[model samples]
Target: METFNLFHDATDVGPDGSEPEGYLCRAARLGPKLGASRLGMSVYDLPPGEAICPYHFEWTDEEWLVVVTGRPTLRTPEGEHRLEPGDVACFPAGPDGAHYVRNDDEAPARVAMVSTKNEFGIAEYPDSDKVGVWAGDAHYMLRRSGHLDYWEGER
Candidate 1:
């Protein structure tokens, strides 16, 4: 029986400093640390005027987020909404579920994100015209317009 606390966990910072291109803010990957296999979970601490991740949606996995503390703005396909502590948001698989969390308030915001872990998944970034393909432990990102013909160089 192993137990842990989200608040006491060390913050995981990105290699590129604050406001990384793809994913910004500091987070704690609690899922794998807690031995979770079917689900992915992370605790994020987002600073003011920064987004946790880019605006994107998964093609095969569903994701949900809980506002743990402070007010964070949720950007969705509809529009942006302010989220309060304990507020929950669900993003279904596909373009309709595209979302991004931004801390627009004066203070930092804490959020917990949980998602269905699929062996294979594709994610699209509508704002960046890029796509991410994930297969097992391997992942790749490519621009939407960078596709090549299947038989382009087969001969």
Candidate 2:
């Protein structure tokens, strides 16, 4: 068994958020804490009108977000969702789960993001519907909504 005290000294301030533009404080997986696997838990500080990442969703990995402060507008393929503190959101792996978190407030928004690395996971963007396959370097788009057929077509 292994135990870590992130509150004590495992605070990991991630690389300045530029691609997405935000500040991330990694509370877990800050050190050599994994054993042949990958998992991450981070607290992201998203300034007003800023996004945590590109408008994308995972196909094999599921992600969960817990709002700790301020409100955010969740952009998904389905539509937009406003999230407040204590609001818990989840994105399952699939084309229907295309989503991203954006801070809509003028104040800084903070949320805890939990993610797990899967052997077979792909992330897809909805606005462009661009799909990024994990463990591989390839991206594509679907012609129809909620349509994801791996190894069934060629791009």
Candidate 3:
């Protein structure tokens, strides 16, 4: 068994030093570091006007987000809504689950994201016309229009 404070264990720096532009603060993936293999968990500290991630949805995984502090805007298929502290949102798999979070308040927002961890998964980015394929720890991104035929070059 393992236990730790979410706020205390979280850091402002992500696994890498940087993230997508327009985002402020840092994100930390805690599940892997904590020996959690069946689920994925991450904490994000977002400054005002900063987004936690791009709008996207998974084909093989379901996800949920908990608002730890501050009110953040949740963008979903139904449209955007403000999430207050202690609020929880569920994102089902597939297109209807596509979502993103942004801190539009004056204060910074802290959120905990939890998801099922699958050995293989596919994520689609509607706004970017791109798709992400994940196998084990490897990830590949491709443009939707660049997909090749299934039997291309088959002998």
Candidate 4:
């Protein structure tokens, strides 16, 4: 088993430049082996009006959030809901799982996020029709029209 202290690894930078004020703690990351690894977990501390994730969906992985401290507004296609401590939200693999967490309370909000790592996750900025894939240090755009097309028959 591995152990980590959030205070020792937290950062005010968002992996893809979502928010400059929120802090994230990456509990785990890639190991020596290849293929899909677990990104252990993340704790996002967002002050009022900040959010996690830029309203996107994953193509190959799932994510879950657990409210650890203050309340946050969970924005989903179904609408928005205020989640308080002990509340848990899950974004299963698929279009319906698209969601983001925004701190709406006056106090700082904290949530724990767990997801699989190193997989190609197709994220779509719905209103912008801008699709991106988290591949290493950068996010590559997949034109809106080509959001789902892919090689079918094996060569």
Cα-based TM-score, every candidate = 0.88, 0.66, 0.90, 0.71
Q: Between prediction 1 and prediction 2, which has the larger TM-score?
A: 1
Candidate rank order under lDDT: 3, 1, 4, 2
Residue pairs whose backbone atoms clash in candidate 2 = none
What does candidate 4's lDDT look like per residue over 1-155, in tens digits?
Answer: 54444434453434464435543322233132124356546667676777775687776778888887888988889999999989988888778988878887899777777776654567767866778887667778866776444666547
Candidate 1 vs candidate 3, TM-score winner:
3
lDDT of 2 by residue, 89-114 (tens): 88777766667888878787777777
Error of 1 at 147 (Å): 3.3
Of models 2 and 4, which has the larger TM-score? 4
- The candidate, 1 or 3, that scores higher on lDDT is 3
Question: How good is model 2 by TM-score?
Answer: 0.66
The list of candidate 2 runs beyond 4 A from truth reads 1-11, 14-39, 136-155
How many clashes in each candidate? 0, 0, 0, 0
Write model 3 residue lDDT over 38-152, tens digit each, in one string: 9998888888888977899999999999998899999999999999989999999999999999998999889999999988999999999999998977989999889799999
lDDT for 132 (candidate 4): 81
State which candidate, 1 or 4, has the greater TM-score. 1
Task: Give, for candidate 3, the lowest lDDT window spanning 10 residues.
Answer: 12-21
Which pairs of residues clash in candidate 1, taking residues 3 or more apart in a chain or in different chains?
Answer: none
